[model samples]
Target: MKAMTYRGPYKLRVDSKPDPVIEHPNDAIVRVELAAICGSDLHLYHGMMPDTRIGHTFGHEFVGTVVEIGGSVQSLAVGDRVLVPFNIYCGSCFFCARGLYSNCHNVNPNATAIGGIYGYSHSTGGYDGGQAEFVRVPFADVGPTVIPDDITDEDALLLTDAFSTGYFGAQIADIEEGDTAVVFGAGPVGLAAARSCWLMGAGRVIVVDHLDYRLRKAEDFAYAETVNFGQVGDIVRDLKFLTDGLGADVAIDAVGAEADGHVLQHVTSAKLKLQGGSPVALNWAIDSVRKGGTVSVMGAYGPMFSAVKFGDAMNKGLTLRMNQAPVKRQWSRLFDHIRAGYVKPSDLITHRFPLDEIAEAYHVFSAKLDDIIKPVIVPAS
Candidate 1:
């Protein structure tokens, strides 16, 4: 099997590796047909996440065919085409029973925070991801969903993570009808969130980012207003001005540790590793929303202390909601939306690469070159 392996910061390559086998009774081995390089994967590529060992494969969004299944995996069988959510969890766990699949207590050593995530760093769970020809899926019954014949492979691939997380971000926002919703970052997740906000009854949606290309996607793909933070003097102030001085009704931080607005914060956190993740976008969310509004965080951040504006959030009576998205929880609604033609997840896929060219794909995505909004990896059979 050929898998994308992480060597060090800014280093990645597709290398031949041993194929994964079923290790647990509930495990299943999937022959990956399509995989995606998520924005969060960049954290590992750039050495932002802790304990991302060398040779670790970094991918979470994928759809594939089941080549082998364990005895206990009764929900699926060989030859089933499935979209595996990023979360790896036991169905009957304390958190899983409450629909908090991302925080399942029975999966990761650090299950106290986030559950097992495919191909994330050791902090989440040291499981190999599907950035290869094959991947072993644990708790297969609870996570992998058969891809409907009506849905395209690329759409199903997006549903595995980016679209699901984006929907979850909007779901947690509790957006009221006619409320103005503002999303930070214009990556796939942000674009999805912005699009989902409209479905959730938001009167207006605005996407904020520093890149013209992504901001353009936000406008075209999500039908939302765009703001380039780099062009503005103060992003929070600009957001407030756009919202007519009171500020937006809701603000979401889709940009996590690698946010670029604050120089000192980005340097200390992203460059120097002094903090968990740069909280610039989160802090901006706090400042950009109106008093008593909601701030939802869907961005991926390391498990270290970040200098967040807790005091200000408390003072303003803001509702701060954040978590690793329970991906499966959003599937039902997303499926309906996709079927209704309200959103096309595949439209955001801007590039595709063969597994052999994964390094170049990573470079293009990490460098933000070629207008690559989302890049998919196709493993040769």
Candidate 2:
């Protein structure tokens, strides 16, 4: 099997590897038809995430056909086309029973925080991801959902992570009817969150980003207003001004540790690795929302301590909600929205690459070249 292997920071290549076999009774081996390079994958590519070992394959969003299944995997069988959520978990665990699949206690040995995530660093669980011809899915009954015949592969691919997490961001916001919601970052997750805000009855939606291409996509895809943080002197002040001096009702931080804007913060956290992650976007979220508002964080961050604005959030009585999204939890509502033609997850896909060209794909996406928004990987049959 050929897969993208991480060698070091800014280094990746397609290398032949041993095929994965069913290691557990509940496991399933999937022949990956389509996979996606998520925005969060860049964290591993750039050495942002801790314990991302060499030879580790980095991909989480994928849809594939079940080539083989273990005896205990009764929910699916050979030839079943499925979309596997990023999280790997046991359905009967303490957290999983409460619909908190992302925090399942029975999966990762380092289970203090996040549960098992396919292809993320060792901190999240050192499981190989689906950025290859095949992948082994653990607890197959709980995570892999059969893709409906009507759904496109690209759409199902996005649902595995980006779309699901975005909708979860909006879901946690608790947006009231006629409220103004602002999402920071115009990546796929941010775009999805902005669009979902409208479905959640937000009167207005605004997307903030430094890139013109992404901001434009946010405007077109989400039907939301756009703001380039690079153009504004004080983004928080501008957001308050846009909301008529009171600030937005809800502010979301979709840009995590790698956020730009604050030079010192970005340098200390993202560059020097002094802190867990840059809290620029999160701080902006805290300062941009009105008093007694809500701030939802969907961005990926490390387990280390970050210099967050806890004092200001407490002073303003802001509700801060954040977690690795329970992807399967959002599928029922998201499937309905997709079927209703309210949102097309594939529309955000801007680039595609063959499995052989994954290194180039990573370069283009990491460099933000070709106006790339979302890039998909197609493994050879």
Candidate 3:
């Protein structure tokens, strides 16, 4: 099998590796059909995530056919085409029983916070990801949802992470009807969150970013107002002005560890590893929302201490809600939305790369070249 191997910071290659076999009775071996490079993957790619070992594959958003399965995997079969959730969890755990699969206590024994995440650094779970010809899926019965007959492969891929996360971001924001919602960052997750705000009855939606291309996509795809943080003098103040001086009712920070608003913050957090992640976008979220409003964090951040505006959030009585989205939890609503033609997740695909050229694919996405929003990886391309 050929897998994308991470050598070190910004170094990757397609290496021939041994094929994964079923290691548990409930495990399944999926032959990767389509995979995606997620923005959070950039955290691991840039050496921000701790314990991302060399030779480990880095991909979490993927859909594939089950080529083989263990005997106890009753929910799936060898021939099933499946949409695997990024979360790897035991179905019987306390967290899983409460529908908090992303926080399953039975997985990732070393971590007390997030549960097992496919292809993320060992901090989440050391399990390899699906950025290859095949991947091993643990607790297969609880994780992989068989792709519905009406769904496309690309759409299913998005649900594995990005789209589901976006909807979750909106869900946790608790947007009231006629409320104004602001989403920071214009990446795939942020774009989806902006679009979802309309479905959640937000009166207005605004997306903030520094890139013209992404901001343009936010307008076209999300039907939301766009603001380039670079053009605005003070983003928080500008957001207040847009919302008639009070502030947005809800603010979502979709830009995480690698946020670029503050040069010093970016350098210390992303480059020097002094802080967990840059809190520029998050701080802005805290400062931009109306008093007693909500601030939802959908971005991926390191476990280290960030300079978040906790004092301000407390002073303003803001409701802070966030989590690593349990991808399967959002599927029912997402499937209905996709089938009804509300939003086509595939529209976010700006580029595609073959597994052989995955290194180049990572480079193009990491560099933000070619107006890339999301890039699909074809294992058989």
Steric clashes per prediction: 0, 0, 0
> Which residue pairs in candidate 1 have backbone atoms (N, alpha carbon, C) closer than 3 angstroms, thus clashing?
none
TM-scores of all candidate predictions against the true structure: 0.95, 0.96, 0.96
How much is the lDDT of residue 265 in candidate 3? 36
lDDT of each: 0.89, 0.89, 0.89
Indicate the worst ten consecutive residues by lDDT in candidate 1: 260-269
Runs in model 2 deviating more than 4 A are 259-276, 303-306
Residue 225 CA displacement from its true place in model 3, Å:
0.3
C-alpha RMSD (angstroms) for model 2: 2.4
Model 1 regions lying over 4 Å from their true place? 259-276, 303-306
- TM-score for predicted model 2 compared with the true structure: 0.96
In the range 1-381, model 2's lDDT, one tens digit per residue, is 999899998899999999999999999999999999998898888777779999999899999999999988899989999999999989998889998899999899975777999999788889999999999999999999999888889899989999989999998999999999999888999999999999999999999988889989998999999998778888889999999999999998888876322222321222443454667788999999999999999987765366789999999999999999999888878888889999999999999999999999988987789999999999998
Residue 85 shift from truth in candidate 3, angstroms: 0.4
Q: State the weakest 10-residue window (summed lDDT) of model 2.
A: 260-269
TM-score of candidate 3 against the unseen true structure: 0.96
